[model samples]
Target chain A: MNAAEIYKLSRLAIFWLSVTFGAVWVACWGVGVFIPSLITGKMPFLLQVDNPSTTVVFIADLLRSLTPILSLLVFIPINAMFMVLFERRSLALFTVRMGPNRHGFDGLAQTAADAVKLLFKEDITPRGADAFMFTLAPIIFFAPSIFGALPLLAAVTNNHDLFKVANLPTGIFYILAAASIPVVALVMAGWASNNKYSLVGGLRSAAQAISYEIPLVLSLVTMCLLAGTLDVVEIVEQQKGGILNWNILGGGALSGYDKLAPYWLNLVDTSFDTSAMFGQFYPVPWLSSIMAFVLVICTVLLFGLYLTGACAEINRIPFDLPEAESELVSGYNTEYSGIKFAIFFLAEFTNLFVVSSIATVMFLGGGDNPIPKWILDRLPLEPISNALGSLLSPLIKDLMFIDPATFWAAFWVIVKVYSIVFFAILVRGTLPRFRIDQLMDFGWKRLIPLALILFVVVVFARTWVVCHG
Target chain B: MEFVNVQELVSTGVAEALAFYFIAALAITLSIGVISDKNVIRAGFLLIGVFGGISGLFFLLQAQFIALAQVMIYAVGITLVVVIALMLTNPRLQNEEAEEEAIASSEPALLKFLDSIRNGFPGLVAWIAFVTVYMAIRSEHWEQSTQTIGEDNIAVIGRALTTDYSLPFEFASVLLLAALIGAIMLAKAEKVEDTDTPREGIESGSN
Candidate 1:
């Protein structure tokens, strides 16, 4: 918590994250843009023109189709490495200890080194273990993470043309469905291990996941009910104005009602058209304002529920009972070794990233500046962007390379998603793990009931707030 | 020219057709494995594979929500619960004990065949049901809907659930509630009795 420690951690985090981002950029550009140009002897941008050579069009299309998968493959491993370093560094800051400082620049290369070591280690299958399942389990656990986060990439990047195919109409639902598959993988690993500790661990994971999933689904369902659509892009679009419009604040409940209430009040008033007078006197109409307040409270509670369930789902600290070292000996993955174990490790961090991104899209405004548009308009950002855009116009507009909207969108997404990730790390630092019975009780008896009530309340309260529809 | 037509076919409708066949093949294979797998837990896991393949088909059909529901409810939730329960009960112990008994008794070959057939009765019934459904599908000249799922299918579902199909939806909810309550009561009743016996063992162990 010391200022110096925080500064050092932040600097370290930024440096590593930039490395990951750079690697992803290079890989994506190399495969999706440069290689196609090399092969076809034409720029991808030129292929977009009317009646371009069909061969050029086909090659570009193929490259575009492959970009999402290629970038995702590059992104996951690098992002996981950055997150591992971030968590260790943050934990060190909390505990007043230096963490992973021996390797490249405050232990940035530590995870990479560990990954190499893991790859070189022996992958062993026990004599009594189900060998096929033992091998397949980690693959099952890890594959969904890659696929599940694909749709979010589209939503986060403001539906960038390259990622538009990932944007299913049932976006968040597909992600949730994919996310749920990992617990099955955990159970499979546990049962296939032929070890008692692994069995117990896997069972605990299954129970915890199934129980907590209710609250998580309920909270997201509540957000969907408020937003009135399942499309992640549309949901994010609805929350565009400011902080007040974000789903965390009832998806613009107050701001929208403020606009509509004066007119409705004037319609009822017989004395004169007192709508202007009403606006002048009571700027925040009382009844709908009260409903908006309730909506905000419910939204906040649902967001909290979502965060808790997400933490549990990803098996982060405070909900890592399945892998509670004191009890279950690393739980379901006790017998995993080498690359199998590496995949599990990678998927865990990737799941954390995916969960954070989901929260950003659903609760925080995805790719939206927190600053209101009016204030942003008053500022000199547009002119600066315009100047920058003019300078890069040839590279941007004609070449289809650097769009300011996509740039800002990606910037804000990174900011919001990483902030959520930092908050998760903070929670891990502060809270102790829950006892098994306590965890069950909290998920089933408390969170689920609260989430259900909040969902019902939002269902009713959304009608009073005009923007929700 | 023939090659160009073939390529065009692949570029247009062949991909979807290929995908449908691939997923259908996978589901059929996995379903067979589910029935034929020797280990109960492995069979349970195979059930998930079958569900996943079916979900892929649902995805190909543009039933995205249904595809997701199939994965969530059938592939992950139900199959995981089944597998966990099977593991917890230690079905291997029962199988080992059964094997020992069979060894001791030394059943005749004909009887053994009959016993396996008896055990396979459920599988036979499942096959019959599948064939019946397959035949029905083949016999019907189905008019497949030309309409694709719109962007607001979820909204359509929500409105339908509340308006046109509200009664059935409410009835389904009631049935689920009933099932949940029944399960809880059964569990609680057993727990009370089990706890009473466990208390005596704990007291004696402490002494």
Candidate 2:
């Protein structure tokens, strides 16, 4: 909320996110890349073989295929734990209070301790509760976030071969469908809780998710329309040139600005016709230019719309009506006591992470460097960057263990994703929760019509302009 | 156009067989539950599982767009609405205790058996439908297409909807719009703000 709070959030995010990803990278490299390479005799020159036996080859193939699930299983818990602690610490900083500092170094292990306590606590089914459904709710709630986010790993990793299996032709649609499944779980949780407050919470969740989902989906649909693809990896690839090429910057409606600025500086260069270049940017002369300008404003509004709808979809602050703690008594999970409660809690944070990843991939340009190549070329940092690449090349060449491209992709993805996460935490610290009726009115009356108009405008204007770098 | 088989994603006939049998069995059980369950809300939840299983079957057929649409529209959207409608209209979610009491003082076992036999009417209807479908399958000549399914078949479907099937598509849109307006009118008609009559009890306090 304050500048100091934001600074603290950035510091906490950078430290904790690095620790989380650093551990994930090492573990994933060992299991997914290094060990498989060793088994197949593809790395560590001493282990190299012209032809591996069929059994060894089969084992390597299996290991490689299993990597995605294994890595996600490992990553989700740790990342959730980090996010919980980060949100707490950031919230505490905002509120000017100390948070969970006694557990470990600066309270880093607080969530770890909390998770363990939750696991060992008694998981209870209320006496009147439908036992089968009560047990199944959390599993349903938790499963989609994992499978739904699998395709995202491909987008975040620059479509690494091992992870690309998760990438479907209808990628974003698959994630969206998967994203919707958790609502059923939430309703099931509420009903099976055998409490009035819980049932109301569940019903509220169903209505809220259903209402907000349209705008949430439409906002992304607009981006997908602009980008002309549903595949997250393809969307990311299209946004690769720079920040201006990102969907947030009108999905390359203004890339002409970035492209033509250099032409402006070189106006004296009569070797190439400036008028033809100008014509190239403005296919319909003044109309194209005006539409391109309008497109930029619309895309920026779409980004805001996406963030708002995503917050509602994931039940973040200003929209967390389902589990509105003061009224609902922990909402649908009210009767859930121990490990089941932990699973619900974990999935909630994971959903937030997945939403941020979607925004990053669709709008902010997943894993793409924000700095334009034209700027980078003139920055006098080429040697240092080349040196850095060489430093990473050994891991790819000598060990055949890590693709440098994947490494950098993962790096930018972490930075972008965690930045969004911190922004969400900021929203949580700042905004008051909306009354349920207000939430409905905002979603139905305001967001939906705006989204539809944006979609139509983007569709019409997109034809007159070049989109995405 | 050819087999970009989803079964091959599992890579062997074993996974294919396993997935098919598992989903089919689940669909059967859940559909039965939807009919037989005493609680309407629980039955609605069971309907979701049934839709999920159907979506899984669609996924196996390599119609992923349809499969995902199945999940989004039917499994999540329709089922959620059904559940909400049940919640709003019939507040009693579970009638298990009353049903248990009714069963405790039920008719004789012979009468129960006779009723069970009578309940086989649905089975008889199902058989007739199945036979019709089986005969249709037997009469039709099936051919495998030579063109392989392109990776981006959604674009193909989109083109067909806009061009070849545009009339039907437009008609469908008109029908949907009609339904939307009708629903609004139905809802809005009840909002008669008459201040003529003052209610005298707690019922008036609710409004």
Candidate 3:
């Protein structure tokens, strides 16, 4: 209710974000580029590619492949810790309370402190527990989020050369498949604990995941149908023009209609070139206007369906019945202790980050600037940037501190993904948990049916819009 | 594509074969554990391990898409359901009865011998089946393709499902539909009970 308190919260949030991003950037560059270069310099045959021996080439290729993986390994834990801290701080802000500001620079290092405490705690195994499965559950839970985020790195970074090889042809499908593995881990953790509550929690998790996965997949399939490819990179490319071309606005379907209209109008004129006059004056707008309006409605519905399904899939608040503390005593992870518990904690936050990144890529147009080009071209910043570019060396310019496109693209992505994360945290603070029966009813009876209907409507309407508009 | 060196190919093949054997050994061991383990819930977990090992083998064969599908469908979906069912049944309840039976039968040596034979019957049949399958695999000649597996096997499989194999695809869908409807019928509560159930269930049950 207090506006000044909100402004102070935003300032603290921005400060913490910069510190987290600065650390992430340093870690990525050190592992992905610097360390590899240092190691490669010692292997002479690795550099001499003309007639290198087979083993040397193999080793070189293997090292090259490890670079992206090393960066990812370095990124996950650090980013997860940052996200946890960020969420806690934001939740505090929502309640008008100060949260965890004791450790380092307004509580920035609180997660690190918590990580240390978790490491020192006693790891326990319950009597009559399946010892092997009790140990393996957290690894299974954590490992998929690591590999799943790898494919999205390429799409999120606009296919940067360092991440280019990480892009698989069946990228989004692979991510989905990997993401599905964690439910098994939760069930394993629960059943292996030899506790009744844990067993119930695990059952709830599996049932929730299975029911919600249908709507989530349906929404993504609708977007893929509009984009015409399963490749995440290709899907982003299809939405590269501006905000209107984003998936939330029919995944460029309206723009596709726009392109088809000018040509078809020229054909229909059949006069001594009244087409030129029409192009300038814009006489009729019935079909195009109606189609655009319908497309917008479908897209809003699609985006809403995607957000709901994604929320349920990742076990976010209101949908987090599996781990509802008041009911199930921390649910499936009740018996997990020490570092194993930390891994579950880490993977949960990482899942939040992953889902937000997916939304940023699919609905908000991956790294594209929201501003259209005609307005951007009229801005006076270009002349100043040209002067600044002339003052810098090629290497410094390539380092991208001054490059306009990459800077703004990255700026927008950070803004979009973080905004989604903030929105999730806000929902956590505001919404109360749903009962299990209501949760099932909402997912199956409402969201899934809506998604299917939207998919069908978009399919027929897209063809009509493209061919006749 | 440029040709890979024969010597390099042989070395990589050796490495891949090593990985394949390791995965195969792990899978077989886990499958054995699935049957032999006294605790049914543990055996269910072992089944997941067996599936995971097979998925690893699929990865070694460079079938990435199939490997992922194997994990998603079998390891997560079917095996989790099995484990949950095993837990719900509380298999440990039968241990006391089994222990009492073992104590009672330990006295007569001939009766114990007959009991062992009865218990091992399924193993003997499984060993025989394994031998026959192994001999068949050893004797058959495989027609190895010269071309490498394509990069986009998912697309290839998708196209085939819609084109040449459309009838089979439709049949699979029909079978799934039947299963889904049957499951709904089995799980659905009676109409007379639905109203009472929701009131008790939502308001008082969970919390």
Candidate 4:
């Protein structure tokens, strides 16, 4: 609406974002750098190449595994808290109502208060529920979100060695496999609750997930094929240098275009045969150019297909049929209370964040400046860069508290991820829930076929031209 | 600080052995629970654990792709469908039907004998399979390969599948396509009014 209200929302977002980022940075530094060095001499894990004691090596190796969980443990709740508040406020803005403003200044502290209340609330197991599975359900649901996102750490952090332990050779496949796991938890929660609505919700979720996972998996698989690598870091690395090199922008179709860009941008007059160079890049001339154009369109559609499938997979509106209140009375987790409910709530948001991060890494250029390097190099950004570098120098060098690349990587990732998150929330506000039959029909008939066609098109089209990885 | 050779500490070490035993124990326990548990759905859920433990063993063996595939396919996809099918079908009705058939026909002496123990027929079959595999393992001369399967094993596998194993891969895909087509044929509905005999019903208009 008005400029003043917009200003207030921006300010609110800044406050919560800083709180999350600041806390996360401190925790990562502590686990990844400080505490380990404090315990086993003042050498960093980065010095593993240097001959170190078994204790030092052991602690370093151990902390590498711990780093993902530790960061996630710190990140999830705060991020979820911010997301919930942001969602409520944004949704309220859309619906023309005040949302949770009574708790704290303009509702900045509302989700924090809600989170505390949830933590202290009574944990209830419904009568006739499977007690063991009922208790284990939330944990099963929540655990995968942490481990599933570990590979992304390397991708997001630009393949920093500290997070290298999280990088698997199978990469996105591992994450997809992990993503498949949470449905079982939902089913368990549904069955253990011994509620009719819960069971229906659970079965619907299984059917939906099974249907939608095809397109989601295929879309990502198509990207992997185009990129020529399954490794997340390699995929991200290939999309580096500029927005044109990014997977979304014709994938590596622009790579040939990319080489000739800097010369034009810098206003260089080449004595060499530019036409011949162009011919060299595109051997078949018109046919190759057309194939490149086709690949670009296919990739864009595949990305949309991914978002649609991912929306259903995570049970977000209009695909959130499993938890539709009208039909299933809050669905599978309806019977859960207190911390368990909080956990399911937290994991759902974290899943959203993880999905966005995957989108950021695979589709969007993770941490790469949208402006090409030559342009960015020529901009009047040196002073600001130097000033920030100086400010972070102590943390970067003396204490090894920050890696500069990781810092900027983290920054760009945040910007890209949160934009996607905001878009998802906007979508939630806009769409109506799909009927169960309609949902399945759309997933299987529309999205899967479209995804398959796009995948096959990409498979053939990529061979005629160079691709990112 | 005390130091140990990194290779000595990890490869063929106590940790690996311990992990192997732990996963094996978990798998055995879950497999037993899959059969012995009275509640069939619960047993189905335990089957997930059995598959997961085996995947964990695969992880230890450094076959990450296979391990993840195991979880993705068998543990979640096949098992969940199996459990759902079991839930939808009436076991009591099946048992009654089977007993009736046994009574109606000339029941095999071995079938009656095997019915005495709990899950006797399947258990005996499983034991025989396990013994055959064990005997095969014993007879074979096993050697550790000098080469290490590095992180880029996926690329190597991909290359081999397309180059050397392409024909077999194509054959497997053809087999799957046949199965898929057969399933669709079985499930497809017909125009009820056109058909005779089995199609004679009140619902003549139903597809």
Candidate 5:
């Protein structure tokens, strides 16, 4: 076959190979999940209990737990592939032209196709490179991308639980701590490549990560304090009373009608006992609500900054200074090629997901169903249920197979994650790349101080509520 | 209050020993690399690795907070600043060849002195000093101290910073402010005259 034909053939082969690789990873995860009893001869981590039927329950729990992560591990690359396609379309739209219209399913698989092209492309290791460190950097950078997903796993319930890979007491802190390692790897990559632009990009990344990380940690700490626990599940539980109960606004009494009026007013007016009357009659304490309002606003502001910072950290568009093709000639990956380059690309996409997922969990009431409990209880059940009794009952039973609360909880989480991903894509489409100095100034001068102030305000509010209440 | 488990003690001992060995190895290797590496930038990178290894050792010791601080400040913070400085400033102009030549010229003398230290009078003095210190510390059977009141560390730390450490903190802040102001001044550009030079001597002096 000619060179062009051979190239096309290899492209197809690589595409199938990636799909198969993703499938195998998923299959391995599934088999490990479903046959845990057969493999381990003991209960899986999820199902371990004090009951006699623990092993049976454990296997079931194992499969249940495996589904989300298995899906996540498989779906991340696919999503990343979509993200690249979306970027292309977005760029096309920006330049006012139709882009990739001829590709698989109207440019849907364009990213996957690009991945195949990248995989088969000539892999070059630059001369005078530090081969070992360069090789190791991508692996180090990629490992944390998987581990970073750990804290995103929601707990089974609002109670103290062990639902993550490592049920670290300082769950959020552990995540922040582990997340910093990728910055090191990036710097290493830049340094090892022996390229000036790569070195500059790496330095910028390190500075950006350092500057934004302070706020990210402090803001999450504020959430943790509001939740009264560092556990992700507990944090979600703390937000259970819907959006009002979410710690972004404040928790408990400070959250709802109580914030509308002082204690004296509540005692004076019996009608103000219910939230509806309070909503109508008692005006929200403009000043106190300001505190909660500011907290939410700052949280969002910091989250936006974080999203931008993460783009920079991962060397993606707008913040893709580290790999700016026009200026830096691929930045930190200037000398990387083949599997090593693939790993860096994989890490970048995974990090995009990681940051978005984190933003979702932190600012967006993490896995909380917005449905108020009273509505669920007030649903008309008898006649509608009786008319289609058998079928509806079984269907309802099947629907409620997973606890309704848990189902809704996971639903909110998925929604939040997707929303954040959508935002990331929007950011990629809209913003232009920032200069290195501008990036640093934005991070340190603007973001870090704002995070510090927000953290202090949150602490003061918590203390004030506790002392007075 | 209670006897420690032998197994736990043994495991902890091994872990500590391993950690120490790794730290020592990393320190030695990096020091060697700093002295020997022809590329100055590569030496700086090696120095970063040394910092990271030390930070990892801190983590293994269960000092998670300290480990994070070390990574945040030293490994990433100071190292990056130093690397940036290395990149901005011409390394070749700043003792690059001189450093290599210095090492080469000093090699024989350094090796001879190291041999002497390894085998002679200083080694005897070091052994004696070590034994004396070990015996002195080991022989001291001080009474077990107990606190009458539980210390709230967070409050104590905050109070200490505001009180005893206040002066130092304030001084550090002032120093940082001054540095920032100086940087600003240095970065500010001045207009030039028609002669392709500054209107005043100020610009030339600043440059």
Candidate 6:
């Protein structure tokens, strides 16, 4: 083939490959809806007798497995774009002014427009800079965010697994390790920029990241200790009893009681029936229950610190001194513009969502159905009672018959995560940037020591309970 | 290295060829860049590429965790630290005349000896090590060992690290603590010196 013809052919090949990949992704979503049971074996409580054809089952399973990933692939860019718009609007609102109201449905398409502008913008290479590393930094930063999602979201089952591309037993650790990679890219970007401010920002980021990373990891380790597995699906399963079973509710010990008084105060009275806290199979040891309570409290505290640390690590507001626009001129990203800058922006939002999702799964009882059994039992299902039940029952029951409880639970998880994200955005809108020294001190003096002490308490409690029991 | 069937042999051969091509390309490209790049930062980044390619070869040899750890700690962490240091020092913007004078003063014989070692020794050792290790690995009865260890179990690794390698892990923690303390002291000393010099100058001027 002639050179021009060969170039055209190569271009066509690339186009077709991308198109085929996109088609497969959409097809997976369609198959996932109809034959999800085939992918995930069976619904949690449902039973099946005869098996489908192995070939058909395998194809369905594969498609179903790819669905969540495909959805995520589509979701990330859209989410990033919308979040940018959201942040702009929120900031405008906070400052009492309209912002970016022109372009694409009153700034609805602002992010997309910005993205296009960035794509066509000039790519600048600073003098004396390493051109290759400068170009490579953003790609490295973005790639890990995508790959990190793989292990975090992947689920597996015996016959079928739901929504996961691959299951790693060390899934939690993989997420931690993978997420840590973007820090390297940030440092690279700073160095490659050949700017003093960028270098300082990068140094500050590294120190801040390494500091917070300890507590973030310790919090996850605490969850692992409680669940006895690092697998995400298993962790969710342990929270099947809904909000009551959530680790934050102290394992349902105070489910029926008025939560006005502290748990320890209630425990001191000994008048209350603590039978509900004990397992049906075995009597709960008093010491173990107390230890478990202590561990849960420590976990919650560490989780709070972790969430704050994550916001800081991502260079979000209040702790966003590294990226303070006024001070450091966009901090480590000072020299970055166009698509390189967009990638960094995308990584930030993606990391935010990831942190929130993890918090949801660990503390908030992920994907658990929310309805209490007592409330369900109280509702009259008989003809005379059916009329009354219609009035008494929640509106959620009318929309879908597939147990509104689980739906509400999942909805709550989404709400909780979004709220955390919203709070992060609000902080960005409201709070002033911290000085770099203050940021470092907050990490080292406050967060690390607190995390370490909490970790020790958790370990000691778990060991004591185990030995006694 | 007995293959049970022709298909198996063909698949193995294809995989091996692909691996060889990538590894060889990476090694040549990175080594050339390392020597040619005038910028110290770029050279450090190139060294990361060399480490990464070696790690990929390790993965092909069925050391998946080790390969990942190598990439994580050395290629990402250590190399990033080096790049950061380079940026902090601002080597590229340093006085060119001073640099030229320093280079001119160095003995030609010593420089030539260092140059020869850098260019020649690593390449020779890499070639010898690759051929010997590849032959040894290819000729081994890997399937027999697979039967003994079972399939793709990471439990053994987890147990080994926590039990057999616990002492090393503890020692590593101590080493990190010491490093942290040392860094703090160095930083503090520099700050103290800066403050003391200013104070002493003010007092002498007042007197």
Candidate with best DockQ? 4
TM-score of each: 0.89, 0.90, 0.84, 0.92, 0.69, 0.72
lDDT, candidate 5, B63-124, per-residue tens = 55566667667876778678667767775665866786577566788786775666578769
* Candidate models: Cα lDDT each: 0.84, 0.86, 0.78, 0.86, 0.63, 0.66
Q: For candidate 4, lDDT tens digit of each residue in B32-81?
A: 99988877888999999999999999999999989999999999999988
**iRMSD value for model 2:** 6.1
- DockQ (C-alpha based) per candidate is 0.42, 0.38, 0.31, 0.46, 0.17, 0.17
lDDT string, candidate 6, A36-145, tens digits: 54344553235454554455455555565566567567767766766676667666666766667678545555667887888898878789776888899898888777
Task: Please give, for residues A1-469, the per-residue lDDT of candidate 2 as tens digits.
Answer: 4676556556666777777787777777777778877766654355555776666656666777777888888888989899999989888987788766678766768899999999999989998999999999999999999999999989999999888877898999999999999999999999998988899989999899999999989999899888888899999998887788889988888877777765677633546666687777768888888999889999999999999998988888989988999999888899998999999999999999999999999988899899976676578797996897788788778876667788888889888888898899889999999998899999999999999999999999988887763
Q: RMSD (Cα, Å) of candidate 5?
A: 9.1
lDDT of 2 at A108: 69
In candidate 3, which residue ranges exceed 4 Å CA deviation? Answer: A36-63, A257-292, A388-408, A466-469, B1-11, B96-121, B124-132, B186-207
Greater-DockQ candidate between 3 and 5: 3
**Can you write out model 1's per-residue Cα lDDT over A236-309, one digit (the tens) per residue?**
88888777778898777755543444345453345555556544423456766677788999999989999999
List RMSD in Å for every model shown: 5.1, 4.7, 6.3, 4.1, 9.1, 11.2
Residue-level error in angstroms, candidate 1, position B96: 5.6
User: In terms of TM-score, which candidate is strongest?
Assistant: 4
lDDT of 3 at A306: 77
* lDDT tens digits, residue span A84-188, model 5: 555555555555566675777555567677788888988776787788788878987887777656666544222212234434445565567567778878888
**Model 4, global lDDT:** 0.86
Show the lowest summed lDDT stretch of 10 residues, model 1 chain B: B1-10
Backbone collisions counted per model: 0, 4, 0, 0, 0, 4
